[model samples]
Target: MSDNLQNDNVVIESPEPVDTTLPMVIYALYLASIVTGGLTALVGVVIAYVYRGKGPEWLDQHYRYQVRTFWIGLLYFCLSGVLMFVLIGFVLWLVAVVWLVIRCVKGFKGLQEKRSPENVDTWLV
Candidate 1:
């Protein structure tokens, strides 16, 4: 009975662990950028760049997606800034915010599932 109890208490671990810490952190930073005025996103992008290609291939997809998100977002913001003179920049800015949020959320979901993003190369979520 004691041996049975001991066996029941034994914990079995996976042969290979999946590490999603950095990806989660990057996703959080991206979401926080909405309130932080893009500073956290800058940090997140830098981390993504530094860590890209250093992990599992599935994880590399996320890093690529994150890096693209930062650059594409910057482009959108710049275009919006230029369009402000015509009064359309405000709307573009709103769209950019929504796009960023969607991308971050999608990335978070993929990370949770331990899978690569489906559309890593797309500009839209």
Candidate 2:
């Protein structure tokens, strides 16, 4: 027998349909950032930026929300860091953590329901 054989015809399958997978993954990454020291959140925000405007309008809303969450969260963190000198930073840090959790959870729920996030423009949950 020959070492290799040629086929006369080949078939290829189409890719699976797109869904909320990316959004869910991003949310998971954001949550994991709590333990990962914000590294995962940086990755999640990059994914959100890269995939933004490339899906259904609803998904676009999610991407936008994710992007905003990253920037706003960063601002909160920085502010809290500066306030650390005054001792109020501890409280602000806790508030920031809670805010991030609420935002991620809300986004996850919206994605699960296949709907656009409510008040996507809001800074608070």
Candidate 3:
């Protein structure tokens, strides 16, 4: 009698949890880039491009943000290298490091809040 009563009218409806692996890996790569001369950042860009549109809505921003980070950092570093003759490269190196650090920190914080970045395509944070 108790079993029938419990099963007759009860219902459970819970939404599936969000997957966080990709975001976590991207964030780690951003950090590791600072330490590993950006080899991990290159890997992060590949992951971002491959999985860009394959995740939840909120996740798209992360992929875009990460990809932007990689390409823009690459552009800055390359420009810096090319302009090394006049000592501008050192200044660019400083700017690129600060830019990357800020963007990564902001992205990680946004991920923790389960929110998308406002300006994923911006060159600077």
Candidate 4:
């Protein structure tokens, strides 16, 4: 009886694995930013910092894509302002589309049992 009680009382504490929240949130906000432009991008930036480094491939891909998207959008806007040509805009659009497809493929690969960094912890939650 005493052994049983002692066994029950023994606390089995295990440390939690490093969180992958940063990557996840960054990717999420990246998408939001793409959809809504700068405002969403701003939010995404904050989230990315907060999340920092999480072990989620989607998050990484999203962050990368979002950054690319943001820059491309800015370039497009600037080029449009300067040249005002529909053809230029179309070319920029094509670039963005290709990047999105590549990012999506990379993200899918990450999801398919790709080992991610273990010590990535951007946010507590």
How do all models score by TM-score?
0.85, 0.85, 0.83, 0.47
TM-score, candidate 1, is: 0.85
Candidate 4 stretches with Cα past 4 Å from truth are 1-15, 53-86, 104-125
Instruction: Quantify all predictions' global Cα lDDT against the true fold.
Output: 0.92, 0.92, 0.84, 0.50
User: What digit string (tens of lDDT, one per residue) describes model 4 on residues 74-102?
Assistant: 56545654553656766655555454444
Compared with the true structure, the alpha-carbon lDDT of candidate 1 equals 0.92
In model 3, where is the ten-residue run with the lowest total lDDT?
A: 15-24
Cα error, candidate 3, residue 44 (Å): 0.6
lDDT of 1 by residue, 1-125 (tens): 99999999999886587789998999899889889988999999999999999888989999999999999998998898899999999999899999998998899999999999888988888
Off by over 4 Å in 2: 1-17
Candidate 3 has an lDDT of 0.84
List of clashing residue pairs for candidate 3: none
Error of 3 at 51 (Å): 1.7
Q: Locate the minimum summed-lDDT window of 10 residues in model 2.
A: 1-10
Task: Evaluate model 2: give its lDDT.
Answer: 0.92
* Model 3 lDDT per residue over 1-125, tens place: 99999999798878678786787788789778878988999898998999899877888889888888899899987898788888998898888888888888888888888888768878779
Cα error, residue 114 of model 3, in Å, equals 0.2
Q: What is the lDDT of residue 5 in candidate 1?
A: 100
